[model samples]
Target: MDVPVLETERLIMRSFRAEDFGPMSAFFADERSFYYGGPLSAGDAWRRLAAYAGHWVLNGYGEWALEEKESGAFVGFCGPWKPGDMPEPEIAWALLPEHYGKGFAFEAARRALRHVYETLNWPTVMSLIEPGNAASIRLAERLGATAERKMEIYGREAVVYRHLPPDLLKEQFA
Candidate 1:
């Protein structure tokens, strides 16, 4: 699959590379990764990285590796995701704790949402956020998404936040 690269003012959203595993593994090993299905072993991290790549091959779209342009550092990932068990595709994001307060996730998510609506022609998108994950919930809200319902994902409870379509999002800024 050919993963298209995207860019924002401070980030280069591109395809995952083998070099990304180091930072990805570190993020997954930290407690901060709890909400993202982590505190995982290095092997698991590798598998997760491979899964993202595979998702692109099978689904035509998947998460992008977030790279900070200035320092060329790997920050996190954000994009459309839908595993077999998910009810629908969702705009998802995860960032290293060190990069948390910098607005990278929000920037990446907004761009990814636009890609879904504009490029992928998806009518709408949702974010399945874990209940206790206040930060992610806030980010979803910030992206003009509102809670639609609660559901279980792989046995864990998640709140489904539905995002406004591109037209509505444009009106919001207008």
Candidate 2:
């Protein structure tokens, strides 16, 4: 299954490329990566990237490498994610510190949600956010998601934010 390229006003959501490793690894190395289970070595980052690519092959739908349209820079990734271990499909995203507060994440995520509902035909999706990660919580709320419950995932507690269903999403955003 080929990773479909998705475009937004400021981003190109596509498959992970080798060049994305540098920026990805840098993000993982920084303290900002705490919420992402990062502060990992470059090798770990490479493995993560490989997983992102392989996910498309296995799941037919997975995270996309987010690229800035104008600069063509690797910004981050956002899209549908459901590894075998996960409880359910999720809309996931992670961006570099430089791209934070720029509405890039919001733009990419809204597009991803549309893909999930309109393209993938999923009834609903959830964003698993770490507790106290105010930014993610705010973004989820901004996208009209509501907190559903708390659960332990990957050995950490996470607050699950359920996004609006297809009909509701269309009504709200239309």
lDDT of each: 0.94, 0.92
Instruction: State in Å the error of residue 41, model 2.
Output: 0.8
lDDT of 2 at 109: 92
Show pairs that collide, candidate 2: none
C-alpha lDDT of candidate 2 relative to the true structure: 0.92
TM-score quality measure for candidate 2: 0.98
What are the per-residue Cα lDDT tens digits for candidate 2 across 2-101? 8899999999999998888999999999989888888899999899899999999998999999999999999888998998999999999889999899
Residue 67 displacement in candidate 1 (angstroms): 0.3
Candidate 1 whole-model C-alpha lDDT, 0 to 1: 0.94
Model 1, backbone clash pairs (residues 3+ apart or across chains), number = 0
The C-alpha TM-scores of every prediction are: 0.98, 0.98
